[model samples]
Target: MPIIYRIAASIFLLLTTIPFVNGQIFEHPKQQLINADSLRAEYDKAPYFGLYKDNYFIFGTSLNHKPSKENTNVKFQVSIQQKLTKSTLPGGTYLYLYYTQKVFWNVLEESLPMKDLNFNPGIGIAKPLFHKGRYIGKFSFQIEHESNGRDSIQSRSWNKISFGGNILLENNWLIHAKFWIPIVDGENNKDLLKYKGIFQIGTQFMTNDNRWKFGLLLVKRKDWKPNFNIIGEIKYRFSRKADWSIFLQYYNGYGEDLLNYKMFKSQLRAGIVITPPMFSDY
Candidate 1:
């Protein structure tokens, strides 16, 4: 084995043998275990920042259109959330502030100009859902704004009110459903709902061993007619001790990019993803 691989293997072994988190032999299992002490350590810290969405960098090209500078590019997204208050507020909900940004880098084009930059920020509250004293899921509501940082005719911006939650279903399936009310007026995106969709619903399935995961998302456009955006992803973890995974994703439909929200496109992307312990972190 190469020197780097040998060193990583040694570290993984050592870390797994150390019972530093919740008396578990391997820290990876800690992603599924959370206790009072862990809660305090996470929520009571000086800076309570955690991952809000899956983060990744990908390089790919269009599957429907012929590959070219306009079709081949690199894409990336970074998302994070900060806990505004350590304790629950009047409604038994935790306050959170969030930010998520995405960039479409036209690496294949000459001069390598970026296609667009979508900036999203929001404030929200989350409440854990319980059924018959058993923890079932979580619900959240937020007021969010999304804009592509551009000047004049290139700029696209909108604000919306969103509410959604995750439910733990039978087996290894988890479902997430979110609905939004667009507040478009002077943003120059008055007809955004025709393509942006009124709501999004997705589900994920994970293997028992945690090595593989599959997911799908569907977005229904606002028009009374049939219009939808479909996305699917499958990811595999190379090692049990790591959070990173090899990711493959397919995007088909409109609204993939804020700058070209009306165009319909299809693409296949391959990349590496860092899976966050969003559920356990809380």
Candidate 2:
């Protein structure tokens, strides 16, 4: 079996065992359901685990720029966030630590060559926006570092401060936008701004029952003239209670990966998305 299959099997086994363990801890079936609901509610209210900003896993493929050859590859991302402070700040602010790793694999190659690995770690603060209800959503500010874990000529790294927000609309529409400010000019990634740009915006439309979702993301950069990248995605839940969902993604333009940041490419892929996007809950 392939390594990806093995990893997926392990994760599925762990997920299946969680319910059995929880059931053993509870004396009665009714008590188990009650406790489970209570725990879930508490988790929902916890910082860094809320909707939109929650952690997720993604596995997919990229067609690359070559279609009639072995240029297509496997892609995956694992992301997580942890709450750093239980106590709220003066204005009800919450602090969090976040990390995400994305990788591309040339599984078809003889040696199973891994193409690129992008590691991102950040600290962020989130606060309620507007009237504190879902009307205006939430605002977040973060400083992040991203690198390819390479050295010398192959090194690619940068630091960015970002301001972002999640907006939930009454019609089951969700919007997320983020603006980035590069902090340091790393020797290997000095021209990153010309390709990555200053900001990105995404919006999603979800079904009322939260079973189906579609979203689009736009990334822009202005060097001599404006350049743009667009990503489109659609997802379907297996069931209301399931933690996994099927996802289809399409991308056009540049900056899909740090190694090929400046290369414009178009691709279509499909995989699983661990959790629903933020502001998807109604």
Candidate 3:
């Protein structure tokens, strides 16, 4: 089997083998959607905003190299989004504005110099997916831009129009996927697509009471190549009542960061993370 399929199968087995307990302790996927909708309605006066993605700070050393300033480093990301519309639009879709920033710091070096900064901002709309009145997941469309802030030969940026969908299973397992078409290519990074694939997919599984979570992501490495950028993550929440958790991630392949998107790399990182109240109940 291909590496991608192997990772996927592993996640499937993990999610299936672990039994979610205390059915009364958590709401169904459909009910969670309803409650989210009701919560939105209650705060119709002001925009609802929260964390847009996993926020974490981690230190890592190359899996392919010995510990060194060039091979060891710290990485962090921050992402947030705000609802733009007070209520659902024509098709029960809600508009939102999003922003995300990723930074690479070579703190292991003498000067503690920074490596790269990726700025991501976008506008998107999302709608709930349902099967026989039961909410399943979400469908989203967005116009986004990402770039590593630099000048001339070193600068990189691109704009894309993307479509994404995910399946929420039993309020414990989630299968998320996205595909995007390049709308505008950066003059300096015309070959960016050679590293950043047009499509990506990931799966996440969480235990009941939201204590432990596992996630795996796969991104194609352009063309018909069998190789893929594989990212795996494991998180352990200190307490069900706290939003902070211990995060560990392993990444292997290209495009781990924008500045060196073309370089093949491998790393194992661990640190702390803060999830969103957006889905705290789950």
Candidate 4:
């Protein structure tokens, strides 16, 4: 079997086995486990300054299965936002800014030539949708730009309007969804929809102690012959007060980078995640 198939099967098996493991070992008192309301209150009280978002570094294989160049690579993402308007509610609106970059490093070669670089920057406003105790939710609308800082034939750039939301359920589960619409003409990226897709949806299953989180994300196009991308992530916090954690990530799909937006790829990575107390809390 192919490596991708084997990985997918392993993930499915692990997901199926997690409930049994949780039942056996995660039997702490219900009161001891942090609930959605308490978690929201804690995040609301946190000081809003300096790095107010999650940051991470991923090192993994490029896994470009096509007849193209493939190698090991590194990925980094940083996001920060500040409150623009204060409201009586616990979670309010804000101004947001985020940037993410991925670099392909030819580690097998002597000089480690970086094959490709993709940069994404987003800026806009965020607002609270609802904040009733354990059922808090927020949404953001942003004007985003992404590009591969190249010239001539290799240059790729586009601007988009994006909207996304984060909702914390009563059971401490989190649901995240986002959609983007390109603000460009056909001359720019006529085939972008074939690979980049229209929207993404994901869900997170949080442990009772708020120490461990498992997530699955799906990105797909809306056409009859659609393309899709899937990502699964697992993270474990070192301590209740720590701002960092161990992160394991897996991806199988296309559009890993702007340079290879139409290329299919798969990868597995392990790294450290700089996790703030709150994420996507407007």
lDDT of 1 by residue, 32-135 (tens): 33343444344434435556777777889999998998989888776667778866677667888988778788887887877888988999988866554444
Provide the lowest-lDDT 10-residue window in model 4.
Answer: 19-28
User: Residue-pair clashes per candidate, as listed?
Assistant: 0, 1, 0, 0
Candidate with better lDDT, 1 vs 2: 1
Residue pairs in collision within model 2: 52-278
User: By the TM-score metric, which is better: model 1 or model 2?
Assistant: 1
lDDT (Cα atoms) of all candidates against the true structure: 0.72, 0.65, 0.73, 0.62
Query: Arrange candidates by TM-score, highest first: which order?
Result: 3, 1, 2, 4
Model 4, residue 148: C-alpha shift (Å): 1.4
Q: What does the lDDT read for residue 72 in candidate 2?
A: 70
Let me know the TM-score candidate 4 reaches against the reference structure: 0.73
TM-score, one value per model: 0.83, 0.78, 0.84, 0.73
Please give, for residues 6-112, the per-residue lDDT of candidate 2 as tens digits.
76456444433332221233222223233333333333354433222312344444465445325576776655566676666667667878777777777667787
Candidate 3 Cα lDDT to native: 0.73
The residue-by-residue lDDT of candidate 3 on 1-282, one tens digit each, is 256336533533333322212121222343454444444444344566566676778998998888788989988877667778876787878898988778788888987777888989999998866665555667889999999978888888999999988787777888888888886467777888878777888888877667888989898766877868899999898775555679999999888888898898889999977665433211
What is the alpha-carbon lDDT for the whole of candidate 1? 0.72
User: Among these predicted structures, which one has the highest lDDT?
Assistant: 3
Q: What is the lDDT of residue 188 in candidate 4?
A: 44
